[model samples]
Target: MSVSTPMLVTFVVYILGMVLIGFIAWRSTKSFDDYILGGRSLGSVVTALSAGASDMSGWLLMGLPGAIFLSGISESWIAIGLIIGAWLNWRIVAGRLRVQTEHHDNALTLPDFFSSRFEDNSKLLRVISAVVILIFFTIYCASGVVAGARLFESTFGMDYQTALWAGAAATILYTLVGGFLAVSWTDTVQASLMIFALILTPIIVIVAVGGLDDSLAVIRAKSLENLDMLKGLNFVAVISLLGWGLGYFGQPHILARFMAADSHHTIRSARRIGMIWMILCLGGAVAVGFFGIAYFENHPDQAAGVSQNGERIFIELARILFNPWIAGILLSAILAAVMSTLSCQLLVCSSALTEDLYKGFLRKNASQKELVWVGRLMVLVIALIAIALAANPENRVLGLVSYAWAGFGAAFGPVVLFGVCWKRMTRNGALAGMVIGALTVLLWKDYGYAELYEIIPGFAFASIAIVVFSLLGRGPSEAAQQRFAAAEAQYQSK
Candidate 1:
């Protein structure tokens, strides 16, 4: 199973292109601010595409499709939930967060925003929130590593450990050198590649497997339930699927896009573009999995490769449907998805370590140059940890993603929403919510609450804790209320 010369060239070029973008961003990055948030200067298109790319991650290409391929249309509900959640996040959180983060002491990171918003002079909120971010994001980053390893293992016949390191190397290199701007720019390119491959491959697959009606006939002959979207969808299942949207409010990588947009005015256009891209790409992913049934039915030999690994549907389709050169580019889309999300996660983790832990506690007066290098060092450390975690071949991309997504959605989502919307939200309540929500997710999953997603219980408990704690406390400070009012006014005027 030697790699084709064309595919090797295509992959090398794609990886080099990413490194080149990092170099370009490196020249413009003058300070720690630029390294972390691109100096908050991204335009609407970059903001929208970067957010979408980071949010979707390898899960969009690998996990969702695999779920559909393995189970049925019931899995598509996750996509539906995500679309709703993303829309709500954009409409409710994006512009307000953009304004609030700036007004709240010009905070640059999520923990920074939390500590500033709560007026926590003792930095309790910052430390707790930063710790939560590190715990969940490490698991999240491992998902991306596993995804990358899977691609190399299946496509080029590499073993797991070698492929894991190979897949992680480029992302680590570029992210260490360039930081936020590099991630955002590469995300834009990767988003376009992802959408292109998703769109093109689905249409070609449908045509190759006869028309829609014919494909449906073939699918029905094998298993009628595969096309039944409501076959096993219960109330709990529906709620769990929709709960994916809750993760949007708390995802550091995606929220960074909102905070970095050049202005609040760009949010409208970004929302429209981002939603359209999400819907189309999600539909394309479903189509790939659904049509894959028919294609594999007709060619049982190729199906054997995917017998236990339905996640490889996209890869197998590309290999079988296109010529070697074109297949290489399509496969590169998978790499793009993996790198786009991995780089964002690593950068976010680095920012937490450097800004919250290192700068806030240890070196409050550190120079910008010194802070930037520390941030880069943190990236290398986190990447090594994630690579170690992903070295286990039993790791499934979706399983790791699910656990981390629930952790963030429950722990941070309610608190973030209340901080921006409810002026009564005290720092005590924010801290309580963060701690309780995270602990609930951990306990729920550890105790085998697999009947429903952890986000449902975690989000509910966290939201309740916030309300109860805020009522018991003295409430937000006068200064905090004033900042909230200012942010709301800006939102209304816009």
Candidate 2:
């Protein structure tokens, strides 16, 4: 797959722009807060789009479309589940987390928030929470790398090993240079590019397939399941699909966006904008996969090539439907999706290492400048670890995402929910829930029922653990209760 001159130029230009943004962000980043959470200064628009972009990742362009391509509308249950989950996460968690993190001793990280919320002088909660973050985020970051490699491999015809490193090089450079602000700023731009590609590609594909009515006729004739939203959906399948929503509540990357917003009041505006963008983008992704059936039916030559790796449907559609110049831009959107999420994940991992481990334990008196440099070093280390994990050529973007999603959802989701909403949540109960939830995900994924998504079982067990242990053991201190009440009151009164 020789890269055309236009494609090479456009792609190079896009990568350079991201690098420039990193340099700009690096100049503005002054404190550890700015390096980790953008100093909680992001406005509504940047906050909303950055969250959306980081949340979607390459799965939006590659994994979701691939699922739809192979399984039809039945696969859309995942998107439907994510939409509902994201809405509830914003409505319930967004405003409170923003206010709570600030009120809880100016907590800058999730582990810090939990430690402060629980009043754990022992710092056990901080250690445990950070460990879980590192474990799951490494896998989560690897998934993004694999997705990027897939794009380069399919689009540029680069070999898998070379493509893997090439795809991650720009993201690591920007993240290492700029830190959190760079991730957020780049995310906003990437979100725009993602929506443009997702929206425009589907519209053109639908037209090429003849029309909405004609496309539907062809899809239905080809495979009724492709159009049938409810075909073969059982109780287990529905719960497993919808359980994806549970994962959002605990995803450190998405929650970081809420914590970084300028103010709690800004959440209302961000929520509306974010949800609207999510719905349109998700609809477009699904449309691309569904519409591809008709497009490929007419062009059997392309269809024959993509049959084995249906995940390439979006890439193939962009290649076949547009001129080289426009296709280059559209394909760059895929890279944008990959880099946006990958950079954010690396930054979060860096924060856990620097803040939770280094500053909190190794050198409590470390200066801000020292910690910032430490974070930059950790980002490179973690990105390299993820690159190694992603070197495998057989990894499916959606498969890796589902596993890591389940890990976080089951491990931290229950703890985060009860920690914020329940005044009685204790450090002991929190520990039990965190351990039980994380272990449940691993054990269930490996040995428990393969038919159900691990999140359902992991979440249920962890939530039950919190309730049972909190009742059986000691409750939160008066200080913890008052803080919880204060945080709850801020949102409830509004």
Candidate 3:
């Protein structure tokens, strides 16, 4: 199918509008601090929406709905797991990390925070953590690129290679120009678009199938098993699905939002707003896929695109059910999803390289102007690497996302949780947990151990390692203990 004039116009307008915002944000980005983290100036609303939008990525709209359309309601366990995980992260980690990061010499990045928190003069912690971030985030960014290419390919009938570069260009440009401020500001808009599409598309899908009752009837006629959430799921399978929640704790993009908030007090309001947005969006995504079964069953002739790739269910439904103009807006939400997350991931990777590696080792006294430019350069370098990885055109968005998600979750989750809550946690404990957690994920994923999600073992072993190593080692130094006490006191006051 060829792109309609309405869709082409809408796409052009949306892309241009985002670039405009980037230029606006560029005016405010004066230093490396603003470029990497908006100078820690985000309020509750931007904090809430940016975190939610970046966390959902293209997986929320495409990969997730496709899983349900392919496997039935059983796939929603991942959604359930995510909701639990997100809430816990906000409640347990958000304010504390915000306070702690500031208290620890006003650290600018996660590795910076960890090294300062541990007083690691050796900078070993910084190097190791930064490497893990670069490794997993490169793969994560590739997933975003693949998602954007898929959208352009499906909608415009463009060849995969052309779509790959074309799709990624807008996001890379805005992120390179505007940096964190641009990404956060655009994320607010993109999050609004994503929720609007997810909510509206499912409602229209339900009505198109004659109503909720009739839709369920059609689905029942097609396959009674589709209604059973546990139809084919075993104990291990269920645990694996639920384990997705663990990944939330360690995701750098999401954590960056927390670190950027204007005040810890804002986290309470942000949590409320963020959770409501998350639950509604997730419910709508599940509805689209589940109700999509009935719609496709009723209209088999229009099912070819979805039949070829179940991930295209939301895209096909939007085009077929809505007016051309409205459909264009709805489809743009997918672009919004892809760009919102990709831009953030690119920035985070750039930060890891510029702040953790280059500034830490090679140029400790680099000027802020030089650092900001270096960060922009790093964005382009990482984007090019991600584009190359996405060149294959065979990668599944969810598959790539899941691997990176688990890598971050296992490697960093235990360390972050322990570091924040337990001042007794020595630097060796963090190092042990980080290494053990990351290694477990890599080894388990490679060996196909127990058919379990790698995060479960990775998190469990990492947590255990932290406790054992910390206990066996000498206590934290007096200065490290004093810094932890001050941060803890501030958090308690909040």
Candidate 4:
């Protein structure tokens, strides 16, 4: 596809608008909390949309569509798993984390929460959790940068490295100025645009292909017999795909929303709003890919080898179904998905540096002003590091993302679950679990066997290590254990 001047104009204007929002948000910052969690006062709609937008990211725009194009109906289960898992995370983690962040930890970041909860004043827990957060978050943020660059490379004929720098800079600059406030407000707006684009683009494609009857006939004539959504996929693949669902309970970026929300009262409303938005958007992505299949089917020469270029399905559909102006708007929606996620990831990475590392360790006496500056600086440094790592630009976007996702899921997922639910969870248990989970992710990759279940193995070992280590290390001294018993009682009452 030729470089459409209209599309270029749309992208530049959208990028500029985000930059303006970032600086606008920058005006409100007075302390680290304002920089990190928007002063811990996010409302229901902003919290819900930003969290969902950040959570879904490039995966929703490109990965989901690719999956539908590649595996047909079985891909839908992945969406189901995510929906259920997200709802549960909001139900279980959101409300409590908000209250506990103040009462138990005074925690602004995940590592702070861990250190405070266990009376980890020794700084061992803080240091370890900070290290864990940084290592995995680095890779996680790289995946987002990769996705952003890929979006430009795939859609607008931009060079990968140029796109990488542009994309990373775009997210980093806003997050630097706006911090969490910019991220949340921009994410809410971007998330809405994402859903609208997903819904509208596909509907247009379906219509352009001449309705359901014509579309199906075209698809049947062109696609593989197995492309049928129902009879097309095998049970194991379906299960594996849907198993992507189990990942939500542990993701840090998603969990951050819960920790930041102003009240538990917001959670119920957030859940309803979040789920409805997710369902519609995810459904739209699938429709775009499947309908793209039909649209191309009707025009055989035009449809050529879209599966291999699966990432372009959404872009191709925009060009085929709408005039340049509408297509430019839809294209901006894809960029929104890319930018929303990249900004959120960058902010989380910055928080780990400011709240978790700088104040917690390096400069123990750093002022709020210093911490915020450090956080902003870390954003550029980290984005540059990730861009350097992602220089290869040679992997499937979903696969690379899953590897990072699995690492975090294994490393933090079980420890968090056991920590929140099981009071016997000793500090030693948390350490053992983190080590085991992190190591297992590396080991699994070394063995090249993630085809089995990327996060499952690491999560299993982490859970076992936590139990074994906690039992082996002597239950907290009697007094400490008694104090924990109160925590347990508090847990039971809740």
Give all candidates' CA lDDT scores: 0.89, 0.89, 0.93, 0.77
TM-scores across all candidates? 0.97, 0.96, 0.98, 0.91
Candidate 4 residue pairs in clash (backbone atoms < 3 Å): none
Query: Over all chains combined, what TM-score does candidate 4 have?
Result: 0.91
**Which candidate number would show the highest lDDT if scored against the true structure?**
3
RMSD of each: 1.8, 1.9, 1.6, 3.0
Clashes of each: 0, 0, 0, 0
Instruction: After superposing candidate 1 on the true structure, give the runs of residues whose Cα lies further than 4 Å from its correct spot.
Output: 1-3, 395-401, 446-449
lDDT of 1 by residue, 1-494 (tens): 44477787899999999999999999989999999999999999999999999888777787788888788777898899999999999999999999999999888999999999988888998998898888778888888888898888877788888999989999999999999999999999999999999999888888898888888888889898997878788888788888888888888888899999988999989999999999999998998888888888988888876697898888888888899889999999999999998999999999999999999999999999999999999999999999888888575643655678888888889998988889999888998898888888888876857878888888999999999999998977788899899988987784
Count of backbone collisions within predicted model 4: 0
**Could you give candidate 2's per-residue lDDT for residues 1-494 as a string of tens digits?**
45477888888999999999999999999999999998999999999999999998888998899889888988999999999999999998899899889889999899999888888899998998899888878888888888888777777779999999989999999999999999999999999999999999999998998899998898888877787777788889888898899898899999999999999999999999999999999999999998998889777887865698888888889888899999999999889988999999999999999999899999999998998999999999999998888887565543555678888887788888887778887888888898898888888866999889998999999999999998998777777778888878886775
Q: What value does the lDDT take at residue 344 in candidate 2?
A: 93
Index of the highest-TM-score prediction: 3
Give the deviation of candidate 3 from the true structure as CA RMSD.
1.6
Error of 2 at 288 (Å): 0.1
Residue 95 alpha-carbon offset, candidate 2, angstroms: 0.8
lDDT of 3 by residue, 262-290 (tens): 98999999999999999999999999999
| Predicted candidate 4 versus true structure: per-residue lDDT over 371-463, tens digit per residue | 989999988888887787788766444355556677777777787777766666778888888888878877886684645566777888999
After superposing candidate 4 on the true structure, give the runs of residues whose Cα lies further than 4 Å from its correct spot. 1-3, 221-236, 304-308, 395-400, 445-450, 476-494
